[model samples]
Target: MELLLVEDDERVSRFVRRGLEAEGYSVTAAQDGVAGLSRARAESYDVLILDVMLPGLSGRDVCRQLRKAEVSTPILMLTALDHTDDKVECLRGGADDYLTKPFDFEELLARLEALARRGRGFSSEPPAVLEVGNVRIDRQSMRVLLDGEPVELTAKEYQLLDLLLSSPGRVFSRTRILNKVWGYDSDPLTNVVDVYIRRLRGKMRWDRDTGWIRTIRSYGYRLDPTI
Candidate 1:
């Protein structure tokens, strides 16, 4: 997934860009709010990570402008402030999710994933059926079967699987997955995608027994090639 990260701190920006790239995401960084806004307006992105305190424009202002301009890309707001009013202000300004500094990378990734899912209009209601390779996901009843046997999956695991199956062979960056699955705005230092990929492999990819959900290696993930 393509993402725009608007942050002023060079150190923070580099750290985040590296982390997101490691998770196989394509990220564009803007040093301040003005440049960030310009980049956002100039291109299409799956998500935006905006810092509350910006040089040219505040994160809140950027969100406000985006909303005013009818840019529907999901936004995750970042800030060091943890006050309730501050959170409210950002949300009111149009941020989908808010995060304070010193956050758990895992939690941030989860939030970002959740947001992406929401943006894609994924149904909370279970699906009737999901088929990927020899595995089948029954959304209506929240059941998964591999090789005709029941397979256990955690809630997050099921969500991730459903996401992959829904878009077979489409590359999904770590940031994209994080927003769609976890509902957060940004995570610059998390290896959450790798962690979850490992978990999914353990559960779904049984050696050569199952061959779905291939990693693109430094890009993201895709479902079985056949879609």
Candidate 2:
């Protein structure tokens, strides 16, 4: 797989590049945001490893521009900013995943593999239809099936469901959800996420007797595993 590694730290860049290359991925390294964004727009890559800080333009900006340009390449953001706000910002900015500094290489590789699999529209295990009770999620077509029937969802709803179903049983805070489904630096007070989640639940549970999206009171929400 072709991978783009955008980082300014020379030592960290070299270390990660060698590790990924050793694992059989063709690695391209860019030391600054401008060069990284240029390479990203110029070529097709399977995944991007972007550092939050760069010489010109932030990684967040690069991610936003890539998404704006409709590049579907999976992005994994790397940074020393471990604050929840920072992580949320990156996700909202268009990153698929976030990793703090001093991370384990093994975990990073695993996350990259997962992102690759998702990008290729394949899961590691057998391809079984995903169902949350009566609601079915068609991974192949990015469509929702309810009661064996198709249910229409807006773009935002689809994205919200995708995020929740991708990591079921994991409680995602409002901030994190905002980043993942919206974009980084979105208005934190906006009820857009809640509205979309309610809409999704309304459609998904229309024919079912139970709810799939469970609210965690003040924390956030999560997909109930038992559903």
Best model number under lDDT:
2
Clashes per model (N, Cα, C within 3 A): 26, 4
* Each prediction's TM-score versus the true structure: 0.66, 0.56
Q: Distance from true position, residue 155, model 1, in Å? A: 12
**Residue 168 lDDT in model 2?**
71
lDDT by residue (68-187, candidate 1, tens digit) is 999999999989999999999999888999989977665666677677777778765545897777778888888998779998898888888888887776677776787778876448
lDDT of each: 0.81, 0.83
For model 1, the stretches where C-alpha displacement exceeds 4 angstroms are: 125-128, 139-227
Return the lDDT, model 1, position 189: 85
lDDT of 2 at 27: 98
Residue-level lDDT tens digits of model 2 in 1-227: 89999999999999999877655579999999999999999999999999999989889999999999999999999999889999988889889999999897767877998999989988688444566666677777877876778888888888788778766776767766777677653475788777887888787763223567788777578787554
Q: Model 2 misses residue 146 by how many Å? A: 43
